[model samples]
Target: MTDAAIAPRRPWAYAIFLVVFGAAGWWAAFQLTLDKFLVLEKGKNAVLNCNISPFVQCGTNLQSWQGSAFGFPNPILGLGGFAAVIAVGVTLLAGARLARWYWWLFNLGVAGALVFTIWLIVQSAFVLGTLCPWCGLVYLVMFPLFWVVTLRNAATGEFGSRLTRIGGILLPYAAPIAIVCLIAVGLIFQLRLDVLHHLAA
Candidate 1:
């Protein structure tokens, strides 16, 4: 066999990405949680640091019914979920080989998070007509994270042999894909919210 074929499949890069982005997500979520507490302790009239402008802020989102979709603050979910992601990344970095079942579960969780983030993005731009800075930071990390983990799983043949080939081909493009996705979101927000108009005003 060729040397390339004999080499073990180790996704060290993806592990590092997971750790870095996961921590970023955690921090963003933590900030949102703190802001949520501030809203509660001081009431809705309280001023928040994240309230950059009328068009971009967190207080409105925090007070919205959507923020407590599961009968609790959504950032509370991020606090736990991102912590798990960090732990999994640390384990992988330690050279522990995870089972296919575990990979599937992780992929599902990450996929769900991506979907939820997308929904939040849409709601923020359209329904709420405002952007939450801390929540935007969560999206910044989540998009790339979902791509990296899913592509890495496919590259490892966790999905199947066909996807394995495609995954390897696509792995290097994950960052670009994530950038495209973010750009798309930005376009949507700009069209709906007229963000630049607000900025120039």
Candidate 2:
């Protein structure tokens, strides 16, 4: 079975990355859940701390149907999902070399999250015409988390040799790509909703 206990490449770094990002994501989700409760307890007219401004607040998003896309608060999903992420990271840190199948599943989970996050970004910026700070925090970490997980799997040959080489080549660029995507989202919000103008108002 070889030395499965020792992950081959940059295991510590990846583990730490996952732990940090997962914790951040969980915190954002936790905040959103609290805000959701406040809205529920006090009614829609409630003013949450997350309700920074009309154009940049969690109230609209929290009250929207999209926030309960799965017939429940979406933050609940994050609470569970990010918890799994943290567990995986902790497992890795504990010197467990996960199987290829596990990595594949992890990749799938993160990719699904990234897709969902993108949809929320579009919905928030264009349709809802508001921004949720807590949701933004979730969105912020998701990009890099997905990118790193996918590339790491590829680099480790969980995909194949071709992707392994490509993943290795592209790994260093993951953070940059995520940053660019975030910037693009910010620009979209600014152009479509006049975020700056609203915040300044």
Candidate 3:
């Protein structure tokens, strides 16, 4: 990337989000990792404080194959990923300008995280039939994290010149789209988990 294309003025909003939610995601992942270790050492029968309910619990998730698809607990990835985000966010806020290639690489990482996160979401909903509260927090933070990264990258013509124009259109709609996504998550949780029935049970 040409030095001429160095990152523009940091979007203070996303910069702030990257700091705040990056920390939140890191904390949630750390908690989940600790809880997973406890489960592993003591076994599934171990009572865990994070086990809030049959539907809202981390134990069920930690014990599942989906939680360790790579032969390790997934939060290990979160530990590194969130830390990188925090570091980058601090740099941006400190008036550092990154090259276009850096933004491309950053978006690639965000895309990968988005894919894995969506898979986790599916497993939690359709397969495990349960939810990890900490995982939920990660997802909550990740949603905007991914969107902002995409929009910023697109704005900078990271994908291509065409997407640069498209990004401008998308920027205005981000808020409404996020609201719709939140409602969709709620509706899906209600439908898939029969949340009301679980509460009554």
Candidate 4:
């Protein structure tokens, strides 16, 4: 039996996290979007404050082709998407139970976000070879958001009873899963870059 099954159902728990992280994610995305625009307008002459150090830089990712995969800065999408999350969170906090279809749609959106974040993480660590501080913050917020949504869907039977049972069973594993993902991300960076040198610099 999963902790979720035996543990008391606290709907507010997820709602509260949704509100907190949703707001935070939006704030980070908004800042990144603005900085991206500023960088584009000024070009090479722009001395981005986010360019704190060689390894701890945002410009490298901003200037990369992947940054504008859809011909506009990715942060623009982040701004919009994170805003949607905030709105949904607000609704959830209001004691509104979203519809099954809405839950399905929300899960789809979060799944896309998960995939998108992973792609950007890879691009930053391997391709671009730089990490955007704001983007990193968004990635950190996304994991639990995605996990909670998935578990909620299962609990509520959006994916059927069997999946709901599985979701409850999976609840205890969420933190471990997230930790493994972070470990993998760190490993990728350590393998691809001179981590000790970059840290010392």
Candidate 5:
């Protein structure tokens, strides 16, 4: 009813959202890590010996260098990053007062993760020519988690009021730019589908 009453509740709402999303991300990351390890340990034998179907075959993706993204396994990054996010979420949910500097640092980490996910999506579509379902889940969860957390930080004035003003101004333009980029990337993959199939053959 009153501004003062509503003001106190907003942080709790954001904390709940963050904790739920962070937990989901952690679960997805854990499952993906297990899949990656299974594939690595068993190699080609993993497919037949482990009862993995073609659709769920981690080996299919893991056998390729793209599975690593970097020189090492990608799920390792997910494990560590999501674990940190989980810790932050739990701390906030427990009513811990995070300093402005800490919120800024967390925002930066989430921003970097969102950017990395975009790159992974591009690689999966064009370069890898395949997608892991579990990895897709992580991408879907992380995208909105990043947006919500950043918005929460802005709303709370953790970064400064000016950032919120900037977000309001840019959201309209940013949405369309993101849509167009996604469509363009999808078209590139569609156009290359024939070439990819031929190479596979």
Candidate 6:
């Protein structure tokens, strides 16, 4: 297909991305909130009986403060953030003309979420030494949501021509991949001692 055809069709792709992201975000939000409620209702006993697998147990991870993250519960953030994303997706789908500044703000929010999700993954894998299946669902949903939003921004010319010109076509994929790698490496190193200690114990 010609570039012209591809360019016009790009918005459809972005729309599809947005819908998928919105759905995933909503699902993650639901799971997180449900898990939190379950924790509250059954307390530690609830988690113990939640033996989905050896590796996937909400109870094991709940023993750590990292599970709560916010002193109360981390799912509350997921519930709020994902709800916002859903609203944005609905707006975009309805052909709303979001300002460039608004898109930039959305980009920043997604970036923050992606970073925090990475931290949570690292905390679960190395520090917590146990995984919450619902938390993993959130991480999985977040990875693509981050990519989709950023891709949509670039394709829709939301980042402004100046920044796009500065980085060119490669920036869209290259920058995010670089950031993900940096976070991955940092997490690996950050949890190294903790992992070792857990192993020794």
Task: Encode model 2's per-residue lDDT on 1-201: one tens digit a residue.
Answer: 566555365489989999999999999999999999999998887879988788999999989999999999999999999999999999988878778888899899999999999999999988999988899899889998998899879987999788999999999999998899889988988898888887888
- Residue 200, model 3: Cα distance from true site in angstroms: 6.9
| Cα lDDT, model 2, residue 13 | 90
Q: Stretches of candidate 6 above 4 Å error?
A: 1-10, 47-50, 165-201
**Please, what is the TM-score per model?**
0.93, 0.94, 0.89, 0.88, 0.73, 0.72
On TM-score, the candidate that comes out on top is 2
lDDT of 6 at 29: 63
The superposed Cα distance between candidate 1 and the true structure at residue 143, in angstroms, equals 1.1
Residue by residue across 1-201, what tens digits does model 1's lDDT show? 998797667668777888889999999999999999999999778789999789878899999988988899999999999999999989988878888999999999999999999989988998999988899899899899999889988997999898999999999899999999988988987898787787677
How would you encode candidate 5's per-residue C-alpha lDDT over 1-201 as one tens digit per residue? 986676433356556766777777777677777767777787666643222333323455666777777898777777788778878877876767888999899989989988887887677666666545566567656766676677667766787888877665554454355456545654654475443344345
Specify the highest-lDDT model's number.
2
Clashes of 6: 0
**Would you list the rank order by TM-score, best first?**
2, 1, 3, 4, 5, 6
User: What lDDT would candidate 4 get against the real structure?
Assistant: 0.81
lDDT over C-alpha atoms for residue 195 of model 1: 78
Q: Distance (Å) between predicted and true CA of 48, model 2? A: 0.5
Clashing pairs in 5: none
Root-mean-square deviation of every model? 2.9, 2.4, 3.8, 4.9, 5.1, 5.7
Q: Native-vs-model 5 lDDT?
A: 0.67
True-structure RMSD for candidate 1 = 2.9
List where candidate 1 sits over 4 angstroms from the true fold: 1-10
| Colliding pairs, model 4 | none
Residue pairs of candidate 2 with colliding backbone atoms = none
Ranking by lDDT: 2, 1, 3, 4, 5, 6
Could you tell me which residue pairs clash in candidate 3? Answer: none
lDDT of 4 by residue, 107-135 (tens): 99989998989999989988888777788
Off by over 4 Å in 5: 1-10, 48-57, 166-201
